[model samples]
Target: MALGGGTFTTMNKILPGTYINFVSAPRASAALSDRGIAAMPAEFDWGPEGAVFAVESGEFEKRSLELFGYPYTHEKLKGLRDLFRNIRKGYFYRLNTGGEPAKNDFATALHPGTRGNSLRIVIEAAEASTEETPVYDVSTWMDDTRIDLQTVKTAAQLHDNAFVRFQAEATLAATAGANLTGGTDGAAGDAAYQTFLDQIEPYTFHALGCLSDKPAVKALFTAFTKRMRDESGVKFQTVLHRYGQADYEGVISVENGLTGAADDTSAVWWTTGAQAGCAVNKSLTNRVYDGEFEIDTRYTQAQLEEGIQSGGFLLHRVGDETRVLTDINTFVSATEERSSDFGSNQTIRVLDQIGNDIAALFNTKYNGQVPNDAAGRVSLWNDIVRHHQQLQTLRAIQTFEPENVTVEAGDTKKSVVVTDRVTPVNAMEQLYMVCVVA
Candidate 1:
């Protein structure tokens, strides 16, 4: 059997769990894994409802209308544009799906949202249509742009497309256009966000963001993150707005607000994307804010310092541009088991990478397939060592030694026990120098 795949609590156990190793503080951190995936529940004018939909970074600009029911530059997609600026791929769940779909006599909108109101269907005789054989050209248009065109002899031949579902039983008629109406966006409530969490549980992402400013909603995300990380061994941090009181490593509380928008909590989206996309070797400290929203970086020097001490992920004005004050998660209360290093998001990234990668390797390569013998153990050891070596080369970890890893048979012949060590590296954030005058 594979390891239970979670942090070790007690040595006494009927079932094997995460391996533990004790070493002196003097010595030195995981696989090399890819990053840049983020997840969040978003409110949209039009999109898939009640399920998570994936959007690639490159697809946002070109296929924006098809995927999201709006052009790339549409005002409704501003938040998505801000998020996709950093993330490679995003798992988005539409929080509002209870609205009625816009419909005319001939067709109905595919999804329920206000954007569907812009849809119009134009039907006319095709060039091939003659007295002997008649066919009509049916076209779906969003504003002035003709998106889909189909030639069919009768309405019965019509089928549902991405944008709309045709009325198969309606008689074919030629008209200027029939605009879909009555479309409306549903209100997102606490239950909608809860539905998002339930649906997104199986997805693998580097970061998750809570766009809601409600204390109850933020608390829900915090609890979900902690459960996923500690119990399920799913490693990812949740970004929150003004939720530093969470005091958990699995959460990054954004201290600053946003400008030019009614919702100040929207800035959390940018940080979520940035944190997810950041390399395992890197940190967001002092990184320039290139997102569309203007962050409120108004804070005195002492306040900024105090913010860091309290584990607030803040942005500050640097020259004419805004930049991150320092990269940190809301884990101010560090204990012996979990050291102060865990407070740094960079450190957590490295550690999470290790836990995730090693668990994946064990589950895929060694679980049930390999015998718990000496040769199999050596092979497992080799793979882990190579994974750590790659991370060390990437500077995500430092001073990694292959000998630090030890793999052995567990109490049962079907199980295995492995204990490893790693030293995670953090980005340089501060420097001090002394000038001597002779």
Candidate 2:
């Protein structure tokens, strides 16, 4: 007789010693896991020329110089600095379709763009005390300071550094400097932006920032966001400048950009990042705008009100401070009977968080592991109740009654059906008071 101790879908008539199956308990997904990630596409001078790159907090300055050929504070990086003012992490993809790389005698620019034209390489004799059997001191310079150095005996021994790659099979020579030239920035077009959209499809981020004011580009982002959210179950919003009457919950249209600035649409960068960084249970209404750009307060009181009614995100002066009037998307209620709950960004955040968390929990813990029976259904229901209870405790939702949740048999044997209701909580944004004095 043979002993069996393995998993089987059906029982077999054979000698068996203990057939056991183990499954872990389902746990709630963490709400903070995917909060602060943002994505954007822009023209850059140095960095990965045509790919999606991840930049963590506090690394923008160093990475920008290492990849883009300039520090974050350089004039060329103004837009990126604005974008990173509030966001701690981001996914940046460059949109340079026909750009040219700067080159010199020893090496070529790692990426194409006008900024790389500033690169210069200098070769000197290495100090005798240095390690690695120093033969030559090869320095890569950007602007003034040396960014990278290498010691080698011959040109063939030289290796590529962070700034540039060395040329192949070149004769060794010492020169004061070799200046790179002819780098150019590509002409930005609709096709370049479309390529960005296609490359970013498989990524996950909380918000996407579109700085272009072109109507065609803005429409592209709107349609891409809708398809991703509706068909693919990926939920993320887009922030664009002056995109009037988009009327979609996933699109945040900025009515007013920065005033007294070279780039009028710079406000979109900060707004997009701030929205991505907002907490799950919080609202961005009344949040102070502390970015580098100045708010445009040209709207009168009536115009401001009209902007809000038409689903625009605006900042107005409030006692020497500029603050957001409401953190709302472009979702206008189509009918009197329809609820305007979807217009509030806080409501959407709560709902999206719930949907993402529950789906992740089920797919990871309970998929194909639990039987489609009363016991398994009850187990699932209990886990869901606990998850909602946690949300209620955190004040993200209210009135989550256990009895309102039900798990029943689906139309097929291997399917299960679940239905539940939830009321999202929003922060108090207005108050009316009456006082009488004698």
Write down the TM-score of every candidate: 0.90, 0.89
- The regions of model 2 sitting more than 4 angstroms off are 1-32, 129-134, 261-263, 336-338
State the lDDT of candidate 2 residue by residue for 102-124, as single tens digits.
Answer: 89878888877787788888888
Q: What does candidate 2 score in Cα RMSD to the true structure?
A: 3.6
Model 1: CA > 4 A from native: 1-31, 130-134, 260-263
Report the C-alpha displacement of residue 103, candidate 2, in angstroms.
0.9
- Candidate 1 residues 105-170, lDDT tens each? 999999998989999999999999987788899999999889999999998898788899999888
| Weakest ten-residue segment in model 1 by summed lDDT | 23-32
lDDT of 1 at 284: 90
